[model samples]
Target chain A: MKAAEKRRITRMTSAGRVELDDAVAVEKKVRVAVNGEEVMSLYCSPERVRELIVGLFMTEGIIEGRWCIDEMTVEYGDEILVDIPADGKVSLDRGTLISGCLGGVTFSSSAGGGPAAAGEVRIGAERLRALFAEFQRTPGLYELTGCIHNAAVSDDERIIAHAEDIGRHNAVDKVIGRCLIEGITLEDKIMHVSGRLSSEMASKCARWKIPVLVSRAAPTSLAIDIAERSGITMIGFMRPSRFNVYTHAYRIL
Target chain B: MKAAEKRRITRMTSAGRVELDDAVAVEKKVRVAVNGEEVMSLYCSPERVRELIVGLFMTEGIIEGRWCIDEMTVEYGDEILVDIPADGKVSLDRGTLISGCLGGVTFSSSAGGGPAAAGEVRIGAERLRALFAEFQRTPGLYELTGCIHNAAVSDDERIIAHAEDIGRHNAVDKVIGRCLIEGITLEDKIMHVSGRLSSEMASKCARWKIPVLVSRAAPTSLAIDIAERSGITMIGFMRPSRFNVYTHAYRIL
Candidate 1:
């Protein structure tokens, strides 16, 4: 993969003052091909393409894990091929193909139901506060453009994996994809994001069977309701010392 | 319309020190219905629902102006209903439904095709810088969340309409939607956002045929390329005294 170049920008403030700083950004295209057919084109910064692919697959529930990945190749240019170990009976649907330049893929849930995982999980509020404190200190790509969101996977006390993208969902997917490729179990991990907690975010965590979620922003009512029913611990407005436990507050000591 | 109720939050810095004052936040749900049927729900602060709805419509190209809106009502405690004059001859396709939460929505672009008025608009960089200076002074939501993105529609030196949302795209959409409902002409206005100039943002601006886009953040290479091809002036890292005019610099002087 080619490395992204950084540029120096001179900016003036609202007060009519000028300051110079360095900004990092990249441009690259990744053409996803399934069964030798192009599905969609993605223009993104050229880092973490493999993790992005894996994370996208898992979050979209297209493939279960590394076991389902028959063969995967990432070219130096703009192509990625992922062969899934699917039976001959499984057919690809062209109707679901959607093109996106910045965001991640959007998929529909199966007809029989909504999210498959149970709705409720539990975690300590203290742990969440600590995790968020650590999260705030971590350097992120967003602080560069003031446009990205960060997602991190953490155990009780420490964040294990983190990714940043212009989209919050993509950030989470990237981390999830990394864990899948590294053979890490998400059974007890907490997913943290810098954006608001929405129903979709909750669904992504529930789908992965992640037990806990902490966010620096507020949660939508639907997300709170979903978390309540799904048996997941949902915490929001997280800061270093205080946070709101929306669902399963009992998990927090 | 329901009145916005403010909630106070105490924020802490990364060093574990609490800030001096409490930040206020508002909560509201934006129900987006097409032709009387609810399609998607957005839970955001109640400050700018009207603009949001209008901007969304404009960017989606569902309606161009107030003439297209047969009736519009914002019922407190219920939902906002926008009745666009629909023609039986135009059949809407359900196959294009995009799902995901804020993060998901941020990454995905409207599949309606590129900007409706791509090459017909331009604005001077000095005027854009002046607009940012004035916009920053407006006491608004972002001063509280430190996470929201602001969107504004301006004509030359005057800002006719402005709105802020937690999501940058939503902010722009809200402004566009406002123009449609209020019968404001976007043909001569410039769009400004508090976030980066990504391809998605530029696409939305192009769709509206807004002549120029100014931002306080950096622009992706694709955004610059799209602006160059579309004849839209893309300005980034905008400050009161100086700004970078990436495309169509001739218009800035």
Candidate 2:
């Protein structure tokens, strides 16, 4: 992937030091504009610009499903401009700075909302283990640059979509964006991330009504509270053979 | 430390599932007010709230060293308010949302200015290795909650100040704030972090004029560029015997 840049530098290994070519992740400023109005500019890995935009809209509760955009163009090294009809009157001004490594902001929405995916979805312990194993096995941009975080969406048996970004939040955004643009419904899917699940992450799942949120890391207390309130099955520290179900344990058999 | 909260969770191991009390890291909103004016609120570990404010200011270029303050108080489960003279005219409105877990915003400053810690400081490789060894040994809140990231400032021998937070950026800010309030100059000291060193992190060290920045992770391409321009010693993937020097290598003997 073009997400990593090769740089010549001195490396120190266990045995000794040597000069070599190393792969360093590339982070760039991407200004996203909707209907000719500047929404915001953020530093992101430029590989998946389209997914970043679509996922941002889905997580922000902007467009519930496939959005009707008149035109969309990505000018490399410049910006990504999506032209919805002027009558669409989309305003992306209300953004809250998110906590990620490369600095990012998200369009904020009210916490008071209806659950988007409220139907009951259950999975056996072995099935959950297999899904996590799929998450662990899917290699992408992270192997080249150790500085990236990964996120993926899966069904009961296999992962459907996976994304890697400089920020875990963005990684989630990319996955959701891909699904939204591809017209895939997330009503009964599981969202797995490679970083800590915070309140924001849980809220994103709740907004989309995704029933199960899994991570290979721990969850913040606020995340658990939100998961409990939203009726989401929050599972963390997911390994090949084990996992911790924080809230809504009934969903996991 | 109150930073950790005990919660009964069902843990699944290689053997079977068991219900146990686990120590989870606490994340709360700490609102910071300057001169009785509400600046912004951040989700942070409740411990070292004051240092968080100071370190935030230091890294943001808000307050250089210890400044005049009439009153400052912290109320648990409430907000932190610091009253300077009305003439202080502190404005924290220019925050750029940082990419950290739990999400946060950082006040922005122009890249143009005098170097805060511009000068030559040399250190032997052995001394640097010892300092990094100390960094790996001092276990704190991270042991309880694997979700948190840690940042610390150290001398040639021992770690002077350390802070842990749900956000790696916030952790660095906490360490800087502690130094500012305690009247410790970081011109020659080293700043070490447990996460990837991004451009913002490098800029914070450059703003404070910390000569040597050591991390147990890789540095981003933009971070390396900023470090090289700022004339700071940037070292990453720091182990006892191995490390990668990204910029201004002359400082390493």
- The local distance difference test score of each candidate is 0.61, 0.73
Q: Which number leads on lDDT?
A: 2
RMSD of each: 8.2, 6.3
Q: Give the docking tier of candidate 1.
A: incorrect
For A171-241, candidate 1 gives per-residue lDDT tens digits of: 78788878776666776788888888766788777766777788888765556666777667776777655
lDDT of 2 by residue, B1-253 (tens): 2788887788776687788888788877676665566666778877787778667764564532234321456778533344332334454433332211111222233322565456557877778888887876788877777788889998766799988888889999999878766666787789989988888888888877788999988887878888888888888878876888877777777
Positional deviation of A202 in candidate 2, in angstroms? 1.3
> All candidates' TM-scores?
0.71, 0.86
Worst 10 residues of 1 chain A by lDDT: A94-103
Q: List-wise, what DockQ does each model earn?
A: 0.20, 0.58
Among all windows of 10 consecutive residues in model 2 chain A, the one with the lowest summed lDDT is A97-106
How many residue pairs clash per model? 25, 10
Model 1 TM-score?
Answer: 0.71
Candidate 1's residue-wise lDDT over B95-148, tens digit each?
222311121122132334544444344444456667777776767765554446
